[model samples]
Target: MEQHKYSISKWCTVSEEVVKRFDQVVFEGEKGDFVAFAKAYYKTNEIDYPKFFKMDALSKLAFIGSECLLMDEEFDKPTSDIALLFSNASSSLDTDLKHCESIIDKDSFYPSPAVFVYTLANICLAEVSIKHKLQSENAFFVTPSFDGDLMYTQVKYILETHRAKQVLCAWVEYLEGKYKFFGYMVGSYRQGELEHTRENIKEIYRR
Candidate 1:
């Protein structure tokens, strides 16, 4: 059997105070929260997506991270050939809390479809796909922590089975006002400067 190898072609990380692409600082927030930083980053980048403001925090974080991760890469393959694999700890609890509050009061209960739509954790994946026009396989896993091994295994299978020419993997966690997003593009070994390994993934997340 031939061993298949995959590499991380590009990576991006976004925290409340900073954004880094390929280990270089691209955006720095002045000790602000994720919301403030997100808006600032959007303005600085001049992103024309109007719906970005309407998305819940989880979707916004994942969207900004994906925007940075997939930026400037012209894909030779069709958009359907890219897969999205994301995992998170809070699993949309941030939005769940709001949704719960909206319905908690029976008399005042009026759940907004906009808020209800984001109750599912996987909704972030859908938002990203819509933004990027990716008609591809996508999955969102809820884990207690970042599980790089699981991501590696899943991406490996997707690539080996020709399900996708590349996979975009991310760990996007948002709860309350805290947010962290780390995402990378995985493709053939020749496509990247670094090998796709659990260690490398952890290292990038740490950075």
Candidate 2:
């Protein structure tokens, strides 16, 4: 298997001031529009509301990771063989709860098929591709817990045998109105350049 260039960023950062323990995290804003949610949480010069480019924490992870890849002036738009390999601990728990709530609210039993589709964690990647026009193979991995070794191996195989030029990978887990997004912008250019060790990933999430 080949290696790739990797860059990472963590957001919706919880303040270390008011809280001492880091087991649980809290968001700074309530849900309305996620791009606006992102704007309120992180600072970036490329952001414009109309651009409304990145929505949801998972999308935000891809947006920031994509920015890192697009940074190389020599690189061009990824044409094909781009794969989205992602792993999550909670596995769309937030969206699942939303779907359940919609059907179980008693007063409102209508289930919009659209919302139901997004209830899958894989929808995050689909949304990213639609937002950025990436027509490539994609996959989502759900695990009982975070395992960096498993994620790294999946990405490597995807790139080698699956012919994926890039793997926008992340550990995005959401639960109880809380979310944490940690993405590694992995690709052909930065092969063997990243330390995808368990400790490193744990550090990424401050876990």
Candidate 3:
């Protein structure tokens, strides 16, 4: 059996203070909350996607990360050939808390359907898929923390099994006012400077 190899072609990281693409700092946020930072990023990049304002924090974090990763690449492959796999520690807790607050009081029991829709962590994956028109295998996991081993194993399995030709894997988390997003694109061909491995992912994330 031939061993399959994959490379991380591009990667992006977004936090409350900075957004980085690969090893370069693409965007930096001023002193403000996560929401304000996200808005500033959107405006600075001139992203015209109006739906961005309506997405939950988790989705917004993932969206911005993905945007930075794909900014310089051309997507000519079939939409179904690309997969999305994302993990987060908080899962959708931030939005869930908001939802809970909306329905906490009986007298002011007003559940927002919009907020209710984002209670699931996988909704972030849906938002990315919808934006990029990706229709491949996608999954969202809630790990206690960043697990590079799990991400590498899953990406390898998908590629070896011919489930997808490319994958967008990420660890995006948003809770309270803190946020962190790290995403990378992987493929069988060597289009990146670094190999796709557990240690490499962990090292890059830590940087």
Find the candidate with the highest lDDT and give its number. Answer: 1
How much lDDT does each candidate structure score?
A: 0.89, 0.55, 0.87
Candidate 3 overall Cα lDDT vs. reference?
0.87
Model 2 spans with C-alpha error above 4 angstroms: 1-36, 39-78, 105-107, 112-114, 189-192, 195-207
Question: Over the stretch 1-207, how does candidate 1's per-residue lDDT look in tens digits?
Answer: 544388889998888579988879999987857777888888999999999999999999999999998778665554887899999999989999999999999999899899999999999999888888888999999999999899989998999899999999999999998888999999998842788887888887787
Of models 1 and 2, which has the larger TM-score? 1
Candidate 2 lDDT tens digits, 51-125? 334244454544444443333423345445556676777777766777787899778789877557666778777
Relative to the true structure, candidate 2 has a C-alpha RMSD (angstroms) of 6.5
TM-score of every model versus the real structure = 0.93, 0.64, 0.93
Quick one: ranking by TM-score, best first? 3, 1, 2
Across 1-207, the per-residue lDDT of candidate 3 in tens digits comes to 533378888888998579988768988888657778889999999988899999998899998998887666566654778889999999999999999999999999999999999999999888888777778899898999999999999999998899999888999999988888999989976753578878889999998
What C-alpha lDDT does candidate 1 achieve relative to the native structure? 0.89
Reference-based lDDT, residue 2, model 2: 33
